[model samples]
Target: MALAQRLFRTKPTEQIVAEGGHGEGGELRRTMSLWQLTLFSVGATLGTGIFVILGQAVPKAGPAVVLAFVLAAITALFSALSYAELAGSIPVSGSSYSYAYATLGELVAWICGWCLMLEYAVSVAAVSVGWGEYLNSFLEGLFGWSLPAAITHSPGQDGGVVNVTAILIVLLATWLLLRGASESATANAVFVLIKIAVLVFFCVVAFTAFRAGHFSPFAPMGVAGVTAAASQVFFSYIGFDAASTAGEEAKNPKRDLPLAIILSLAIVTIVYVLVAVAAIGAMPWTDFDPERTEASLSYIVNLATGATWPGLIVSFGAVVAIASVVLTVIYGQTRILFAMSRDGLIPHIFQKVNPRHQVPVANTLIVAAFISVLAGLVPLGQLAEATSIGTLFAFAIVNIGVLVLRYRSPDLPRSFRTPLFPATPVLGTIFCVIVMAGLAGVTWLAFGLWMLAGLICYFLYGYSHSRLNTEVPR
Candidate 1:
């Protein structure tokens, strides 16, 4: 009973309302509109993962990879619904971390925030590395010059030494974020448009070369292979929930949050499925080589068409798309840390916004430095898988949090309630768990170690430092 009281209890809604109604510390501006919020979600969702994951996923499931993309999209849809409801009920910058705090208590909230570091921070690194490869390709096509293979790749992976291009991209993102959130969002919307155009172009060109025979031996590896490929492809869906994280900034979070989340996911999924169908139709599924998995989709297009211009266009699109990902992911990361610092779960530096720009400068720098090191040194595949495990675990917690909140605060005014209540959230949880189970053992070990480190930091610093522990006068 004592343990339950300690772990499951939360402050009353009255207190939560009082605290949330007023800004924490300084008056941070809420300037984002519905269009900007939607663009943020779209920008974060459509990035390097989709540009390259097909090569790795298609070889596993053949034409069945199309089904895997659909499966992953369905799973993501459930969780997006859950997020929409929670964002409306308790609009806050911390995303799932804030939701867990309101329903599950401070400790779990802290852990969720820690887990989010993997989703945003590590994801930024992984995507930045992807950007490097495309940038290298672009330069090689345009200037006929490329960085030395040793400097362009990560150490201990296929003769890479530094991944200098990845480091450069991360640094650029950090600089952009330090400028201001509103400015970054505007730039992101433009990039999102360009990226969508490029994918549509790919779909058009590839469909021209479509052949019916490519899908004949679909699922040659069977259902298990499809599920495994779905697990891998699931990483492509990570950014759909980014809209929920911007709850504090949205003008009408209740009405707009759900629209952004669902709309972004649906658009991205359609693009993904179309691209997959077109790519498969253009080439035999058996021809996909997983060993060259890091190459941009344009490389495959060039190989299939024997034309260099289409490949160059795709490469250019990839570079811009990845830059947009790094920009938006870093934005999400700073906001999350800002919420944690406001709650006293971490140092105040994360919450310190520059008065001139009203941006979380310290938080951005910290995230950029960590991402720079990871992108500069770590192999892309390892970083990508590890990011997938972390994101799926966070999604599972968010799904469970929705159910908990529905029961715990039944009267909380929600702008959007998940359509099917218990069924939707329950299915969301199960889907996330199944995908998580399919991750490699090494990825799980890395995730376990990261969680352990987070727990230690919470016990050593966050538990006692938490603002929740500080008494508020009646």
Candidate 2:
């Protein structure tokens, strides 16, 4: 009975938020402002997906992929509202993990953190692979030369050795992170500007050749196809929670986190809808080949403009866009690990901040090295589904956490609350599960195995090591 009770004991919210600054090793500097936080979320969420995912998804739903974007955004908004409320109530660095720990229990919190570790690591590695493709394209266009496929492509692909370019980009982001959070945030903002600019430019150019004929078969595959595409494209919005992970760093987390979360989602959704309209309007949906237009937006712009320069520019922007994605995701990853480490759920080394940088250097380095290896050698094209499942699982938990908190601590000072309360969170959870149902069976198998491993690790190490667990007597 004691063990079961211990397993489900909720950590005090005051303790979690209060301890944010007084880490075991050192304090993380609270330097980020509202706009910086907003841009951080934007940079993290808007990646090469808008450039690549549209081609594949468009074929599934036809021009209705625009509706797919809206559906996915609505699904994400449920969880985003939950996150905003929780982050406002308990401003800290752990994102859903911290929220779960406070509202649910130590065991659930450990699982949430573990899932996040997988989500961010796999996400950064996946973006790195896409970055390699665009980097090669940019080089080929400018210098008329590109790296041999053996080094640029992942192992097991056309006699390839390893994706050295992907590993390089991961290392580059790691170096920037070691510089400090404010520095990395600034760099990410610049990259975000470049990506948005390119997308805006594409919309302008592609609309020049827009034809109403593309909308003829708008619902080519019907509502089922739209839902399926929405499920797949939901991964594109995974980083909306990035601001919540930076709670400790935000100058005014309660005010900024919620605004950043909502604003970033609105901005990314608008960009996605416009890009979808432009892409489909410029070319027939039947011609948007996933294999042929790996860089979909760039391909459409090239076809519409009948010029190589525009495509080359789009590719260059993609390269820059992916770099920012890698930066922001890795930033969130390190912060999550930092929170776990500070709570004694993991090694203290992860929480140890560098005196000069005010960042968890060791934690960042460890995460970067692991993801670099994955980017270098693994063929992660099929594993993107795994990333989606992990994210959806996290989203579902955040939604529940909101409901639990409202019941447990109704008076908690939440700067922002989900307006519909029970209904919003309930819908969020249901929508996320619906999306998860669309993933392949193999992905579910892989996620289950991963969670099982996390449970074992928690029982062996996390349960005993956790600060909350230590408070209970043997």
Stretches > 4 Å off in candidate 1:
1-8, 11-25, 156-161, 377-384, 472-474
**lDDT per residue, candidate 2, 1-474, as tens digits?**
388888888889988988985555678999999899999999999988788888789888989999999999998999999988988888899999999999888888899998998899987898897677788899988889988888888899876798888999999899999999899989898999999999999999999999999999789899998988888788888899999999999999999999999999999999999999998899999888878656677788889888888999899888998899999999999999999988888989998888888999889999999999889998876565577788888899999999999998988888998998799999999988988887789999888888898999998888888787777543
Distance (Å) between predicted and true CA of 29, model 2? 0.7
Best by lDDT: 2
Q: What are the per-residue Cα lDDT tens digits for candidate 1 across 381-410?
A: 654567777777778888998888788778
lDDT of each: 0.81, 0.88
Clashes of 1: 0
Q: Report residue 106 deviation for candidate 1 (angstroms).
A: 1.3
How many residue pairs clash (N, CA or C atoms closer than 3 angstroms) in each of the candidate models, in the order given? 0, 0
**Shift in Å, residue 296, candidate 2:** 2.2
